[model samples]
Target: MTQRFEYDVVVVGGGPAGSSAAYEAAKNGVKVALLEKEETIAETVRTSGVTWIQNIKEFGIPDDCFNPIRNFSFCSPNNEVTISDTVPRAAVLDVRKTYRWLAEQAKNQGADIFT
Candidate 1:
């Protein structure tokens, strides 16, 4: 059997960028299809999973969804660097869960997601 799909917009990967693109396009009333190679979207994380706290807030991600990083350190053979913040500057999101959230948003906007 051969199946065919036609869409006004097709977004690939289903990562944050793709999901957001599909959501935006679909919300504008365009037919959108989001294609993801993974059997389960976000089964693997492609990102470092660390982002600024401000970005997390702007995206409406709940505080509990990520763990705040308050201290960090990097060391070389002869040198070292360390950073400590009174408030967390970065947070590590539960990538799989986060991706699902983004994909859900796209689906709610009428984007067809295939993973």
Candidate 2:
């Protein structure tokens, strides 16, 4: 016989938003299910993988997973400018690792993850 499971909340996609939602819901004792059509999470690359430092801290992303960028360069047909900041203003992430981490978090929180 096949077993059936019911969920109070169903989140589609295994991206950052979906994983976060499922994690929060399950952590709060809700029966949450996260679905991903991909064969594996983070298999597809959709984002530029750039995020701000504030967001990284706020989201508790690990430092090892990203590289800090304190300098930026802007170029035009006739003009080019470069600027650097004392503190890292942005970061470049390993998208595959980042998504996997988020999915792991959601799973650890009791969210049923389906890939």
Candidate 3:
């Protein structure tokens, strides 16, 4: 027999946006399912970068998934830019691991995840 599944909301992609949607929906008592085209979440890091510290906390991303950054520097042929803070307000995420973490968060929130 073929198994059939249904959900109130279906989200495609296991990336941040899709995962977030599914997570929020699940948190609000909605039956949601998250689907990823890749065999695994974050199977490849296409676009990844730095983000604010508050986002990390809001997303409940673990410390192990990011490296806190307190400084930034940029250089060009005619100019150089430097910025620093004693307290870290931003972080560089480990893309692959962080993506997996996001999926896990959605799962924990009661959303079904299908890779």
Candidate 4:
């Protein structure tokens, strides 16, 4: 038997977008329900791992989540340096941990997170 309940807002994913939305909405005293199809929230990294890092700071994300890699090299198909930049940045994220943290934030805001 399946039981269904109504909510003011139902978020269909546990990814960044859906999780953020659910967190914000619930934080503002809205009834929210977050649904995730996968057993683990983070599936894979579809985009490049590089990011300005400032973006995450702006969103109040913790710096400990990233690995500070000061040096990185780039090589093309022909072994040409198409692009290279010496910037203090970080990579290597525990995707599962990130998702779990985000989901926890949403849950803390009174959202009902379910798989």
Winning model by TM-score? 2
| Candidate 4 residue lDDT tens string, 1-115 | 9998889999999987888999999999999999998876676545444555666666566666666556666777777443334775555555556666788899999999888
Q: Give each model a TM-score.
A: 0.84, 0.94, 0.89, 0.78
* True lDDT of residue 114, candidate 3: 91
Candidate 3 lDDT, tens digit per residue, 9-109?
99999999998899899999999999998889988678866889899998888999999998899999999999999999999999888888888888999
TM-score of 3: 0.89
The stretch of ten residues in a row with the least summed lDDT in candidate 4 is 44-53
Local distance difference test, per candidate?
0.89, 0.91, 0.90, 0.76
Q: How accurate is candidate 1 locally (lDDT)?
A: 0.89
Q: How do the residues 1-115 of candidate 1 rate in per-residue lDDT, one tens digit apiece?
A: 9999999998988888898889889989999999999998898886778899999898887766799999999999999999999999899998888888988989999999998
How many backbone clashes are present in model 1?
0
Off by over 4 Å in 2: none
Q: Which structure is stronger by lDDT: 1 or 2?
A: 2
Question: For model 1, what is the error of residue 84's alpha carbon versus the real structure, in angstroms, after optimal superposition?
Answer: 1.8
**Superposition TM-score, candidate 1 onto the true structure:** 0.84
Q: Judged by lDDT relative to the true structure, which candidate is superior, 3 or 4?
A: 3
lDDT of 1 at 83: 92
Kindly report the root-mean-square deviation of model 1 from the true structure over all alpha carbons. 1.9
